[model samples]
Target chain A: MALCQTSVLKVYHAVIEDVITNVRDAFLDEGVDEQVLQEMKQIWRNKLLASKAVELSPDSSDGSHPPPIVANNPKSNKAANAKAKKAAAATAVTSQPQIGGSSSASSLVALKSSAGMAAGSGMKNGLVPIKQEVNSQNPPPLHPTSGAALLQKQQQAASSGQGSIPIVATLDPNRIMPVNITLPSPAGSASSESRVLTIQVPASALQENQLTQILTAHLISSIMSLPTTLASSVLQQHVNAALSSANHQKNLAASKQLDGALDSSDEDESEESDDNIDNDDDDDLDKDDDEDVEHEDAAEEEPLNSEDDVTDEDSAEMFDTDNVIVCQYDKITRSRNKWKFYLKDGIMNMRGKDYVFQKSNGDAEW
Target chain B: MSYQLYRNTTLGNTLQESLDELIQYGQITPGLAFKVLLQFDKSINNALNQRVKARVTFKAGKLNTYRFCDNVWTLMLNDVEFREVHEFVKVDKVKIVACDGKSGEF
Candidate 1:
């Protein structure tokens, strides 16, 4: 069981590294420098990664594994740093063999069989661990209803003496280097006294939300939701909140008169610096506000100019080299009115293939 | 960089206001933009075959425009100048397609 968790951790770490390295590569390919990478690192980690970890990890009925540094609390900053390293390194070797073994088909079948008996979970909102024999190749949209039934079947799969509580990774587990040491500041400098910590991410987090997906089944829900564990950078968190708040806003239906929309949108945007919950009913007009994140960039010297200040027209055209990769839902013709399914991988670091087509004649809902 | 852009004439003020509303959301399509330009120009620059080149940076869609006389650029946005650069104008609309491009030798 411990081996399984360790491997899961390793997989998630790999995913994060791959995502970050890919961003680094994308910038480098465009001849950008390390400063850009450093700037993006915090945003990506805080906005996407840490939240995803909390999203995917199964509810802790998986046994209270020593409460993580509970009694053996480190005394000083140095002591804490040293303790973290020892714990990280000690688990690396034991999990290495499990990582290798899980990749083979025979072991996966055994793991699945064992997991079948470990059924009946206390997951929130009645979410059950995927009990079906997980087939990685043909990934299906695991709807809520289907997930529950699948768990029931898995419980049946577990015969006398063998249980299915432990989910052997049934997805494509990518190879990732276990641990990485990142310096918050340059070594040998005065700031070098700051904690130099070794972080371990589960390679699984990068490769596939395989673990997370099994737990929640809410993959294609909305473009702007995150898990509780989304820690790391405070700046990115605020940005994420702002983005999600903006995206999920109930797009106000534009009337033919457009008088209400004009006034309301103007007021919402003006007071936006103060209240983020300002929802403009007309999102079509507010389309590329995401691009204007330049205003919200904490590191940049963004002028304290409000939308009202740029009187002549606040519109300016910029090149689309903003390093966003898009994965848009091709068939958005679903019966659920209009749903935007974005599997943001660039990190598709993207906002779907952006194309301006078929303008609506005033009375459209979405 | 520090001139009162919306200076003097009624046309300049109206064009400035119109440009803000037109491009407020983003770029408009060429066909849509042409219709918008016609509202400002059909009576003013009243010639059947007067072809116009769009000079960016200056929001003078309503006023009569000039062509780029020399091979030099006209406006500068984000360090890149608006030369005979039609390729960079793909995802964007020609918001200000005026009579000539030779506004100034920047």
Candidate 2:
């Protein structure tokens, strides 16, 4: 009796497995939407759980519990054979309609026989007593539009083959239709696992290029808005240092040139003064012609003074030109007034040029 | 990232790299000191307006000093000796003065 009960449990379990497998495959093949498939799977899972509870019940008196077998060894050949026979019968019933051309009458006979055997066994143990009651109380709802009507429609369309079904026209323009998306799954799992991704269809559903452009423009503007005072300050310092050094070098060069010119002029003046002393000594030697000597001495002295005046004028001109050049360069390079004040206050004016500074009273004093 | 506005190819090294490279490394010598001057000289005659003059003063030696102007820029070395200006070159240390009439300096 125990062997029989175990065999019956095994057979029921196998039937449940077959149903679950079929439902899963149908869901995949039909491209069933996830929400609908999830609801169907939930119902099937509840049914499976309930059936398992019934099979595993310990009380023999419970109407849902199968009969307890009295066999000493439940795994005997007889028990195995009975279980195998039940499985074969179940497979035959399922395969017949799927393979096609099994007459409706034969299919009905097989279904009735299985149903009768299950009912009879269930009644012996008082299991599933409410199943028949429920079936009688409420019949399965009929399709609003019958399957036969749908079949007729399909046939008519096939015969005509001129117009396509108008279902495509019902799609909303704004709706984001599902498209296949492949994304990498978490590591260490099987490589076959794919993440759920909902890709919008029709391409125009997303203005990807425009969105990217707007984002890029905003990023650039934000970055540009940041204050770069530190960097600017460092750059300005370096620039100012460079300019100051250049100005210094320039001043040194101008000073050296001026010194060379001044030294040459000094040497010329000393030579002229020495020549005058020699002419005086010659006049002393020829004292008898006094008027002639005095006339020649006056002539020589006038030319010497005139040459000194010309040299002074030349020196003044050189100073003026140098001043103009240096001032212009300083104004152009250090226009910020930060460095301008520094240059104006520094030793720049003393090289070869005359200093020019406006007094506090706004007087043009140089 | 730091940003800078560049004109007439005078942007130096250390400038942020970007599409601005076209305006920076395109013709500008990197690390050279340059003063920004506002001038409208894009025409052919303006093109021949002569190479922009840059006067630089540097310490030649302890007692020897030098002042020179050149169109080309050279890193560390004398501009007169460099002969050619690289797209990215360094200026050792020198002052930059804008010769144009616009008063505001860089």
Error of 1 at A130 (Å): 81
DockQ, per model, reads: 0.02, 0.01
Q: Whole-model lDDT, candidate 1? A: 0.27
Model 1 lDDT tens row, A1-366: 122222333333343344345445444555555664443333322322222222235543145332323312322233456557767887897787655644453543334323322332211112222223323332322342332323333333233114333332442334331321111222223432212222223333222221221221111111112221232232234434644444333232211112322233444444432334222221211322322322233123223223344553533322223222111111112233322211100011111111111110100012
- What TM-score against the true fold does each predicted structure earn? 0.14, 0.12
Query: Which residue segments of model 2 deviate by more than 4 Å?
Result: A1-300, A303-310, A313-366, B1-100, B103-106
**If you assessed candidate 1 against the hidden native complex, which CAPRI class would it receive?**
incorrect
Query: What residue pairs are clashing in model 2?
Result: A1-A69, A1-A70, A2-A69, A63-A126, B12-B31
Chain B of model 2: TM-score?
0.17
B54, model 1: CA deviation in Å? 57
Q: What would the per-residue lDDT of candidate 2 be over residues A147-191, giving only the tens digit for each residue?
A: 222122222222332233332224443454342211222223344
- Model 2 interface RMSD over true interface Cα atoms: 37.0
lDDT of each: 0.27, 0.26
Worst 10 residues of 1 chain A by lDDT: A355-364
| Fnat for each predicted structure, in order | 0.00, 0.01
What is the DockQ score of candidate 1, to 2 decimals?
A: 0.02
